[model samples]
Target chain A: AQTVTQSQPEMSVQEAETVTLSCTYDTSESDYYLFWYKQPPSRQMILVIRQEAYKQQNATENRFSVNFQKAAKSFSLKISDSQLGDAAMYFCAYRKQYGNKLVFGAGTILRVKS
Target chain B: EAGVAQSPRYKIIEKRQSVAFWCNPISGHATLYWYQQILGQGPKLLIQFQNNGVVDDSQLPKDRFSAERLKGVDSTLKIQPAKLEDSAVYLCASSLDSGRLTDTQYFGPGTRLTVL
Candidate 1:
């Protein structure tokens, strides 16, 4: 079974600063997909960024980026120029290349301080 | 375009009571998923559907929980004699195509259930 682990249960970042959320996974399959999702107080899960295991170039979406190290099985999300809106419960998810099932990590609560 | 829709944003019931949740996926989406999220934890996939057919229900407690997507669009999940452990937020999501590697799943505002 594939499992995702998010080491940081809570993270604090100041506005206009940068913060990184740590994530690691254990998988025997080499081809898979990783994703970072943000859930605010409203309880809507929003996709922040995505990364394909086969791609070495990390995925970047605006102020959000992921440092995906396939060999080490580490996928961390970096939020730059952190804004108040970035405060949310962030989840790290994994899916096989040919599978629809998504396994998610416990989650990390991000707090943006002014 | 409108995102996924879920009815009854909040629900409360006793341990032995029955409750049901409704979900309407995004227009034209072929894949729909139901997830259960306990407080302070990540969402766990309960069931998945591909156009009215069940793709996966291994994690769903069939003895007490039931879900169906009859018309391939709208879905309903029911729990008979719900348990206090079942208290959680139920989330519905949809994807354009489950076969695509990059298909992104869009989620709806979850329905929070409180079972006492």
Candidate 2:
């Protein structure tokens, strides 16, 4: 079975600064997808960014970007110019290229300090 | 486009009580998913549906939980004789097409259930 691991339980970042959340996965399949989701107090899971395993170029969405290293099976999310709204529970998820199911990590709580 | 919709934003029940959750996926979406999220943990997929047919329910606790997506749009998840361990947030999500690799899943405001 495929498993995702998020090492950081909590992360603190100052407004206007940058923070990176680490994620690693174990998978035997060569083709897959990775995603980062943010869940605020409202309990809505919002998509932050996503990366395809076959793509060499990392995926970037506005202030959010992922450093995807396929060989090492590490996918890290970087949040630049962190704002107060960025404070949430961030989760890393994995999905097979041909599968609809997503396996998520434990999650890391991000706190943005003023 | 409008996102997924879930009813009864919050639900409370005692042990051995029955409860049900309702979900309406995004318009035209072909894939719907149900997830259970315990406090301080990531969401776990409970069941998945492609239209009105079940795609996966392997992780679902069939002994007590049941879910169905009839008419290929609206879905309902029922829990009979709920247990304290079932206290968690239930999230519903939908994707444009399960067969497309680039399709993103949109989530609804999850229903928080408290089994006292």
Candidate 3:
């Protein structure tokens, strides 16, 4: 079984500042995928970013990026210039390269302060 | 494009009662997923389907829980003789194609179930 861990239970960041959420996983598969999802008060699970284990280059979106270290089994999410809208519950997920199911971490609640 | 759609955004039932939630995936999406999310916890996959065919359902409690995706589009999840611990948010998600490495899932608003 694969397990994902998010050590931080809650995190706070001032608006316009940067915040990083930590995540780690245990998997024996060589090829896999890592993801970060955000769930706001609306209860919608939104995809923030994703990284493929085979690719060493990190994945970056408009304001979100991921630091994926396959060897260390760590995948962290970085939010730049955070906004009030960024406040939500962030989750780290893992999926085998050829697998269908996704395993998720407990989750980290992020609060953006004005 | 329209996102995944889930009906009855909220439901309240008593223990040992039965409840069902409905989900309609995006048009042309071949893969659909159902997840259970408790308060303060991340969403957990309960079942997965590909074009009305079961792809994975190992985590589902078959004795009390059941789900089906008929005609490769809409899906339904039912909990029979529900337990108090079954209170949670049920989410539905869909992907264009599970075989594609870049396929990202789009989620619905989720149905919040409260069992007393």
Candidate 4:
């Protein structure tokens, strides 16, 4: 069984500032994938970013980036130039390389202040 | 591309009642997934399917929950004698690969279920 954990229950960041959310997971599989999903008040789950376990270089999408530490089983999301649109509940997800099930963390509510 | 589609955006039912939700995955996607998202929590995988065959249903509360994907294009989830804790949003997602390595999954808006 795979489990994802997000330590931060809620996070606040000023507009144009930066913020990072922490995530950790327990997985016995050597190959897997990680993802970050954002859900706003509209209640739609949207993909934010993804990281492959085999890749040493972190993944970056425009203003979003991730620090993935495979050995430590740690993956974190970083938002630069944070904007109001970033305000939402963020989730850390894990999936085995050979299975289709995705294990998700509880989620961290992010508030972007102006 | 059209994202996954789910019907009955909202549903309210009393305890012990039965309800069903529908989902249409992205065209050509072989893998379909159903998830339960409780308020203030992340989505939990309830089931997974490859084409018309079920891949996994370990976390599904089978005592009252049932799901089917007849032709693999669209699927339906049902709950019988709903429990109060079943109050949550049911989400549907689709991926290009049936295997777990797919990093991208398109999700639907989800059907919010309320059991009173």
lDDT of 3 at B116: 97
DockQ ranking, best first: 1, 2, 3, 4
lDDT of 2 by residue, B1-116 (tens): 78899999999999999999999999999999999999988999999999999999999999999999999999999999899999999999999899997989899999999999
Candidate 2: Cα lDDT at A55? 94
What is the DockQ score of candidate 2, to 2 decimals?
Answer: 0.89
TM-scores of chain B alone in all candidate structures, in the order given: 0.98, 0.98, 0.99, 0.95
| Each model's lDDT | 0.96, 0.96, 0.94, 0.92
For model 3, what is the error of residue A73's alpha carbon versus the real structure, in angstroms, after optimal superposition?
0.9
Which residue pairs of candidate 2 clash? none
User: What local lDDT does model 2 show for residue A19?
Assistant: 98
Per-candidate clash tally: 0, 0, 0, 1
- Against the native complex, each candidate's DockQ, computed on alpha carbons, is 0.89, 0.89, 0.81, 0.77
Q: Kindly report which residue stretches of model 4 are placed more than 4 angstroms away from their true locations once superposed.
A: none
Best by TM-score: 1
Candidate with better lDDT, 1 vs 3: 1
Q: Candidate 2 chain A: minimum summed lDDT over ten consecutive residues — where?
A: A43-52
lDDT at position B25, candidate 2: 96
Instruction: Name the runs in model 2 displaced over 4 angstroms.
Output: none
| Local error of candidate 3 at residue B68 (angstroms) | 1.1
User: How much of the true contact map at the interface does candidate 4 reproduce, as a fraction?
Assistant: 0.89
| Tens-digit lDDT string for candidate 1 (A23-96) | 99999998999999999999999999989999999999999999999999999999999999999999999999
TM-score of each: 0.99, 0.98, 0.98, 0.96
